[model samples]
Target: MSGTLNQILNGHLSLYGDLPPIPIGAYDSGLNKTQRQFRRANKISLLEHLATEGWDHFRRQESVATGLDRYHPTKLPTINPGVLTSKYLLLVIDGTTHRAQSLAVTGGWEHVVSCSLANMNSLPNLLRDYSAEWISICHASDILANGALHALAGHLQQAKTNTVMTCDDIIVRQLWNDGLGYEHRQYRSSVSAIRLCTRGGIGGLLTLDYSLFKQCSFAPSYTCLEALRLDVLLQITREPIKTTHCHQALVKHQGSKNPSMPEQGWPRERCPFSDKQLDEIDRIKSQHAKQYFGIEGGLKPNPLQAGCHDLSRPTDESSLVSILIPFRDQVELTSTCVKSIQQNAGKSCNYEIILIDNGSADNSTIEWIKKAIKEDNIQCIRLDEEFNYSRLNNRARQLCKGDFLLFLNNDIEFVSESILDVLLDPFAHPKTVAVGSRLNYPDGSIQHQGVVIIPGERRCVLEPGKHLKEQEVIA
Candidate 1:
């Protein structure tokens, strides 16, 4: 590895702690022996030349050949190619408006620049001006860690062919509550079949070489930039282009705020979506789904499963469940909760209990939990902090090794023996993601059957009396 590239790798390791060992020449292994040797020789020569002649002299030399060739009619002034020796353009697009922000100057990047989705034709012109070999397109609000840029640069340097790279982003959602004020929730992105069916492919950041960018520029008249980008990406699957995903959350998406749209309708000339255009988009998605997931007709199985099932377990112990319950100092309630699961669920059901103790002051409760762990009856996780319902469940999820995860409250007890069977039955279908059971008070009156949004009320209400019968409800 070159000194610069090695430094970049070390910087990433520092920020993320230890990372898995990366295979050397993994990107270029496909190249023939001669091609690989020639490329390496050229890279070494270029590095040596850059070190001796300085950037300005190299830029001036490349400028002499600018007017000799024109790839497109929208020709722009070409910068000295040497200026982009070690840099890659970081193109940040506004997710809502599909317009690029001029963040290059602020980021102190000579090659990076923003552009509107409609004028993506001018991308070729911009690339020519900056002479950037690679470009990374991401949302304007994405917060990149310190070493993210270096990692991307290193990837571009090692990539043998035209490649598109994507990484998971930490999605942060913010909401204003009437009583609690502003609330922020952060979670890792988990793209599921249901989400894909509704929203389409991983629709976030993408990095690609300039050659691939030219092939997949935004359509000038496309109104929905998100749909257009997805289509473009899917279109490339037919070609020999390589696509890869980085597992780490290199970018943080500020999903709480919407970008300001241009006063003039997007695309400058707001084109109405015709029926034919809409159909074409759907057809493209269908093709993508079939090619990628082997699902015909681009349709997911109906996740909704209605009707009750008799309390029975399959001969095979495939349906293992992890019951996660968060507990504090209430030893009596916690003990009762465990006993209820044991009695109602019975030995027939394949389930394990995960008790999360969050700063319990009572010694009796702590000792009992420890005893349960020692006996191997239940798994106990200790958290010496205040109660955070979201964090507690999120942490417990990592420890769970079940096919299905069930989250419960310590104060609640299972009332019916058939509840687990009923809930597990729905998940037999591939589309069913979550199942909620009816909650009843001690008196047997309904506490919550389902939630109903009253149109004018501006608040959703727990339907206490209605939706009593077994039926499918819109989430």
Candidate 2:
């Protein structure tokens, strides 16, 4: 296998003139005509297997001189694998019939446990019985990336007693009609954002102290069990437990390439949660909002779509907001923006507009700024220098008095009266950091729904819903 693989690799390397070919070793045993034919036919599959087994090796050998950074692999966090001991346990949860195949991965582990789909209810008791200090749980379908086990074990050993650690997951799905499975897409794990975006939580892999599991309430029914990790995380948040994500470890999850397939845990393509499940999630979120932010309200159903909340909360009368707008010489646009904000600042919260004059050379713009400063709610600051977006915002932010800051462009004119309320609604949850809105062109065409930065060299910044009709609803 090694000799054949080396020859296949060399053949590919020959195409790139600068690189030297890896020397292929002589075969210890002669290959039959049928074996040689099979090897040639399955070359691609063999290469994929090799890549999966040694992702770290290739990642480390990245060549900056050759401009190979464009294909940059995920940076692996440093970890010592010496932590794995008999006291640590690996638990495999397999819902499929491939039990023996799944158990094969845990061959060398000193302490390993497995639970079938039907026996999932007994997991809590099993944890109590096991005398392990740390426990790592993964699905049967998950294929651990090279060095993932060691990385996980190391993280478990070093993490705090109350910490719950999870690794990154790469979702692979078979797309072709061939019996062999090939992945079309790779998904970065969303487990780290569980605190802010609870709905994005995905199950399959986790490592944590055994005591933490004992404290968390396991799912009693089979339906809830599908999203078991999320339930555990929700319970963990109620306490002082710390949730950590290990980017060094990789877990490959085999899912369906067809979007129509109903996935159980995460909301990958569509809403995976039932009405009852969603209600339960909303109830918990409401409780947390009240407890943490002193905000009282349940999530209202989204009128435009099902399985999502409108995230609207009652107006917080006491909270103050600072709206910062930076402008140069466009007085008309600036005037329209300020006027719209003043007229549309709803009863959601108290607000003040801070207009930053960034070297306005026009007399009309300077005069407008002077007159705008006279208002009690509006403040004007003159920075007659080169414009820096960050510098302008920071200077205004330091002087402004508000619990939250809203950065606005000088050209933005609000058409909706409840814009502030809608934008601030997500902030009701303590963990939400920022909120964004959809922007439209003058012709009633979509400018952008949001900016998405993805892992790539070219076209990293993607604008979804661009050029679409403004009336069209985006999922």
Candidate 3:
């Protein structure tokens, strides 16, 4: 192990862990004080070299090329790249692996730890998400205490710097509110899921359990974030943060059940995944890979495949859909409603059914669902208010992520093909926000145009959501 890891770890434990914070100046990877040490230890003649050279000396591509090109006759041509992503002129010492599944964005001097493992394919998904400005693949196998120190030393001795900056442009987010915690939830089954996946304690990247590799923990803001593409960790100046909000870590919807909800309504509180989270991980990966990357052969490395699930314990991740069923204790109707939804919902999207029990006689509905499928996908929300349809739907919508929401009644039965691709196609357009369908009673008479919001009224009662052409609604 490199001495770098020990010093950093000890410094971390003593300073941030149990000891007081280190009163050090700013610490970024590229222009770090440590890197300066590496530079100093290495080429002391670097200053002389720079003094004798001009800007043109660094700009030429010839400077970066490996002189020993004749060694491996079959090796693919390597691009000795330099990066200007941050104000600092980040330079790439090496390039990432040229894996077919692994995507390399043009332009950068950064390196990803994903290469630490040999069998692991290419740079990680998070780095690709950014198509990072500058990065390279220099796999560091040794977990040394002074690993950073050595790397800096190597850089100084081995290579010369074209330009050094005061700091980096952006930093990988590892704050409490970041999504790393949420992503790992796919690894958990019950409370265990919540604990293992929580991002608060993990602090930064590259150090969590297998869960760190999963994409769910990747915050939404971190789109196109390939793990390799990320710049080295920044050592920032410290300042106290003022927290605004904290999410109720895991949903404890058991006691918070709505008063009106009947016994046979929603699923019970168990875990996020049914037969453990591992079952659902790959599914989530495959589905998402198709969505973003499409069937194209060459692209970036597909995201990690651990949080997705199988049929026995399916996990939903296509686009999150929240099914909010607001009902009074009509057990029979509730069962019928849930059954219909479960039957019709084939695996194109992730569906979460939140049953808001307005007020019910018994609570069998939640328990029955729990037994049937401990899919962390489902939730039973107990509402505190009476059956105010509009309010409940609004609340659910806020939580919903589906491109289009499905508001089904306890009595309504989907007899024919549900909105697959054609009917709700208008939603593809940004302007087409809501679509009204032709609603019909069991006997086939027009029950609703799918909506009719009276003057100043809050609710838009479904006039119809059945078979109808787009023009029919316009007329």
Candidate 4:
């Protein structure tokens, strides 16, 4: 079995290149014979280890001193059926005042204002009239889509007493550009985000049995709700808690206005966390990281800097990059944009600038472009029709010879010398289809972090006013 497991691990490493280890019992549906064998071997090994532990524990226990029980086998403990059907109490925390109001309007569930942890204890008693077997605790800023509450209630009612359920949140940006206007920029939570938050027991929204809450109550020592939430999750982690993820986008999270929370501070209307409270929260996070991940140092902060690369390296001419730019006779802007790319993209990045002229009426612009074609490695394609963005790019793409294609507007200017390399690096991963860079307006205000599609909308929009840090976002 050990040999078989080793072979499987080695096979996975060989097949996937230098990637993370394949988890036990995880097999691709389209796995070949060898891969299937590895998964089966791992599962069998785990079951055998569990059986050994159970046997060892039973043997260590002393037998009862009774004449009738002398020859009989030892009896294992039986589970109580009533424990599986315990009722629940949904505890919604008032994070943002508006979130609670939204939930009330959508869910039509009873609400209470609890100033302290002690006040929460009386909630179950207050809700005796309602026959709920599970409690759902969520923030006020979390808005449940229509029928979300009913779906959650149905899942909790049918789920086993020990299971804890949480659904995915669709993060929606409501305010754009400091109240310039409102738009919905909605994106579903990623699997990695959901796993990290929920597995650590600090998930924002939760639906669990009332019995679990009775075993672990909220800590009153922490003044901040975030701290209390973490404490509760830590306590829950002590037991073998079963987590069930309802993979639907049932909740809509009100996007934070700040680049991050607490650092930029909460909204002016919200209560501020003291310096002392912040220190304690930091301590808790540090302790959890050490205990769970075995790291002496704290977790690394986000928007990590790109690694340095040598710009002096010789150009790999074979690895050609085709830059397609569409223009309708803004010759000055087009010239400036092309010059910036040529200077900053480094001589080592073998690239050709393809200019698609969409009916340029200026004789000087046409002559200047013709001169560029002879002097520089600029490829010009003329279209005597009106400017159509999609059509122009597609026609240019058909003529380009590079392995990697970069679609650029005639007005876009390069900011950094390594912009080309940085953008191209992510393509090494086979799953990555396309990548986009952060766009900023002339005055340094953010124009786009990434585009998001609103529900029931044909066009995609960016989050107004909020400038997002560098991270992977679903486009």
Q: lDDT winner among the candidates?
A: 2
- Weakest 10 consecutive residues of candidate 4 by summed lDDT: 304-313
TM-scores, in order shown? Answer: 0.36, 0.60, 0.28, 0.40
lDDT of each: 0.49, 0.54, 0.31, 0.49
- Which structure is stronger by TM-score: 2 or 3? 2
- In candidate 2, what are the lDDT values of residues 146-226, reduced to their tens digit? 445676665565667877776555445343346333222222232332232223334335677777777776545433333
What's the lDDT of the predicted structure labeled candidate 3?
0.31
Error of 4 at 85 (Å): 2.4
Q: Model 2, stretches more than 4 Å misplaced?
A: 1-84, 94-101, 104-108, 114-121, 144-148, 174-199, 202-204, 222-226, 242-244, 256-313, 326-328, 342-344, 356-403, 415-417, 430-475
Q: What is the lDDT of residue 253 in candidate 3?
A: 11
> What is candidate 4's lDDT per residue for 1-475, written digit by digit as tens?
5765554332222112111122122222223454346546766553242234212322343222111111122221121222222243445564444555556446544542232333455544545555555667655555565545555655565568766676654433332345321112222221121122212223335666656655675444554555555555555654556666655556544544211121111222221235555455555554554455323233322221111011111234467788999998889999889888878886556788899999998988898898888845688999888779999999888888887788999888888777776566434323235656667777665567532122322222322223322121111
> After superposing candidate 1, which stretches have Cα over 4 Å from the reference?
1-87, 95-109, 118-124, 177-204, 221-225, 256-284, 287-475
* Residue pairs whose backbone atoms clash in candidate 1: 303-431, 303-432
Tens digit of per-residue lDDT, candidate 1, span 173-199:
232233211111121232233233333
lDDT (Cα, tens digit) per residue for candidate 3, span 1-475: 5564443322221122211111011111112344455446765442232222211232231221111111111211223443223211111112234421122132222333233222233334434444322122221211111122222222333222221111101111111333221011111111111111111011111211111223323222211112221211111001111111111111111111101111111111212223322223333333333343222221121121122111111222455556677777777788787777677665555577776666665668655655534656666656768678988888766666565576767776655454332234333222234545556766665566543122222233321133322111100
Whichever of 2 and 3 has more lDDT, that candidate is: 2
Model 2 poorest ten-residue lDDT run: 20-29
Best by TM-score: 2
